[model samples]
Target: MHQIEKETVLDVRGLRTEFGLAECPLVAVDDVSFQVKAGEILGLVGESGSGKSITLRSILGIVRPRGRVWGEILWKGRDLVPLDEAALRRVRGREIAMIFQEPMSSLNPLLTVGLQISENLAAHTDLNSKERKARAIELLDMVGIPAARNRLGDYPHEFSGGMRQRVMIAIALASNPQLLLADEPTTALDVTIQDQILRLIQALSRDLGMAVILVTHDMGVVAETCDRVAVMYGGRLCETGLTADVIADARHPYSLGLLRSIPRDVAPRTPLYSIPGAPPSLNALPAGCAFTARCPVAGPECRDVRPSLETTGRQRQVACHHREEALIHFSAREAAQ
Candidate 1:
């Protein structure tokens, strides 16, 4: 959770993404803003359908045909939003790379893992075929794949779930991207394997000086791996702060609910906590706060006005009309305990 003072590698401002018909589009991400610094790991966390993945896809320029994305995505002070397809091609996989959630579906079943890595190299680099092959093997080895040379011809199905995820990481790193986008990279792995993958990613970020944006629903993962975190709900950021700060003192109710739900140090046989009700539908969101329906402290005013994300401290932000009251309540509860 250390905040590095390196240069900002990526700055996303007012990023809005929408999909569906031209007349009746649903906003998946709404005016979301965040920053990632060189060699820093930033986590985007929320429940499913909270726009975590959509925000990452928008930044990678991989949104679907019907999807519309707007706002500035600045990479090293250069705006990437308006870049044409060809220009984006040069940026994608080279300047920026993404490792998807499901490795089984992302990797090619027919192609050798080495071949896939070589393909990425072939597309983005000037390395000759021989050099590319050599680099591919090196990448596999770097990602801890056993018998890299012999596994060059192995298909996706030949590898286990954890190994497949490593292969995905190897491919993403083939281009030496400055920014890495990992969407639920550890979702399918067992607990032990998940720890390995997360540690590998954290180590890779430090060693390669690569900035990373990790999207996940696991609060434990974010707490253990990220320097900072952004909590999203209903297509908007509910809270953002240093990982330790937000986890220890969550200002937004949504963030507080998420932290409280985690089974940490509770007595044995105690029922697990959970946020009540479901997230609001993006297509038919209420005019007021999207979280009003599920918020325990929602008042009449909460149903009539949406609160913008406001700065609560030097390195914290939250969106809630009763932020002050919530802070006081949390403090009082902590004192009582």
Candidate 2:
């Protein structure tokens, strides 16, 4: 994937998001960088509170009032970090759209589904009242909502979980955005519905040639959907590579642990592997590697010095002191098991 050249849609560099007091702020995202090319799906995967969602919010300049975001968010070569609210408003939803995790909370309860989709159309497109209504129906139909014309007046609660998600996707696709940011788009849905939502997103991206950054805690979802994966831990990227390469040969210890933690069909009573210890508290993060306490191969240097993300192979980057040795150690352990 990296060998072939493609148009870069989004290039994030040294992104740091902070909240709370300025003097002693909680670093939600630290020195994170990645790129998304046209018609590509980049998975931002990690455990909860790993700054995956915050990174997306920061990129859109939608962080809470108490929070501050720094670093370059280059969308089609334009840096969005320094843009004012008015400038950002023009970029968001028009050129870049986001599908939130929970459609119920994200969608307005008082507004009808038609009106909600029309609102985005009005905001981003030049469609008039009649045109907006017709486009809304088309969008709904495109997202596979049955009886799209008749369901225009339905409220958020009137639809099932899966239908609500489709409506959200319809709203996101209202303006034909070039980039889509999806934050756990299938959260709380059943497995079957989750698959539908994931497939819909993948198909839409391919059809529209839209670059997507999908945030999720599930590595299994990444394995199935993403072309590239960036594994984050305690607000920092641990490893990034093509999904297949990372799944088969992860270089970071945390990335390896996450891959090994996925549930597999084994004999009855077989225990699933789980990462030991919890993620580090953002406010109390260590000066060295955040995973030092939980890392199986952590050495004295890992406890004292932080490792910067370094190129390990083609299209692969890892932030670990023992990148080479970690792969060997984890591979042997999995073989033994």
Candidate 3:
């Protein structure tokens, strides 16, 4: 694997996505902001409907027509928020590519595997039919597809789930994209295949110097593969920092709850702890902290004021009124967990 140059590849600041409704707007992404440097893995984690997928959609400009967006999404120093349709199209697969969560639905069953990959190459490059075919074969091989040259005519249904996902990754990398947005990229695969795919992504990001933003709710995956981890709650970023720090010394109550709920591998019989309350609906969120309802540590102060992202003892940034001080008390126990 090649070394990545030290630099920031993508920066998102104060991003908010709101869907317009009859009398009220639904805020799907609420003032979420973060950055991904070149050649690093950043994990965006939250349960379903917590806006993890919506945040990725916001970055891709796939929000509904009635949605309102606010904030800057800078890619390679250019703000993608203001880009026109044509320009965005040109940039989509070339500079920034994405691998969908459902690999089966993502690929066209009507088109052969080679045709799909070659189409992307043909669209972006001035390559002849022969040249495009050659590039497609190479991409398939690069993505670890066995007997790659002979599979050009195979349709989506011919491949297994893992192989289809490998094809999706190959298509996303067809243009040698600088940044790859992987939304639940390995969710459908079995454990062995999941690890294999994650390893492949890690290898490729290192080899190609590509920045990766992975969306998943699995804390174990984040701990294993991410350079940094960002926890989202109620459409907002609740915490973000180096994976080791965030996993070891989480500073927010919600984050603590998430960590606790995961089954420990070493201590096989340890009971799984879960937060009691459900997550808040965006339309009817509390006036103060959105997580206050489910937080065991929430106090009168937690319900009175929303906390900004503040630096903590571990140099982690957490959004909680008491995180900077009180959360550290649980840090040692969490690390041992």
Quote the positional error of residue 85 for candidate 3 in Å.
1.0
Q: Candidate 3 has what TM-score?
A: 0.92
**TM-score for each predicted model, relative to the true structure:** 0.95, 0.97, 0.92
* TM-score for candidate 1, residues paired by index: 0.95
Query: Worst 10-residue stretch by lDDT in candidate 2?
Result: 259-268
Residue-level lDDT of model 2, residues 1-337, one tens digit each, is: 5776779989999999999899889999999999999999999999998999999999999995677999899999999999989999999999999999999999999999999999999999998999999999999999999999999999999999999999999999999999999999999999999999999999999998999999999999999999999999899998999999999888899998998898776668888899999998997788889899999889889878999999888899999998777788887887887
Model 2 scores a C-alpha lDDT of 0.93
Clashing pairs in 2: none
Give the per-residue lDDT of model 1 (tens digit) for 158-241. Answer: 999999999999999999999999999999689999999999999999999999999999888999999999999999888999
Q: Pick the candidate with the highest lDDT.
A: 2
187-293 in candidate 3: lDDT tens per residue?
86899999999999999999988999999988989999999999998898889999999898777887887887887664667666776878888878776788888
> Whose TM-score is higher: candidate 1's or candidate 2's?
2
- lDDT of each model, Cα atoms only? 0.91, 0.93, 0.87
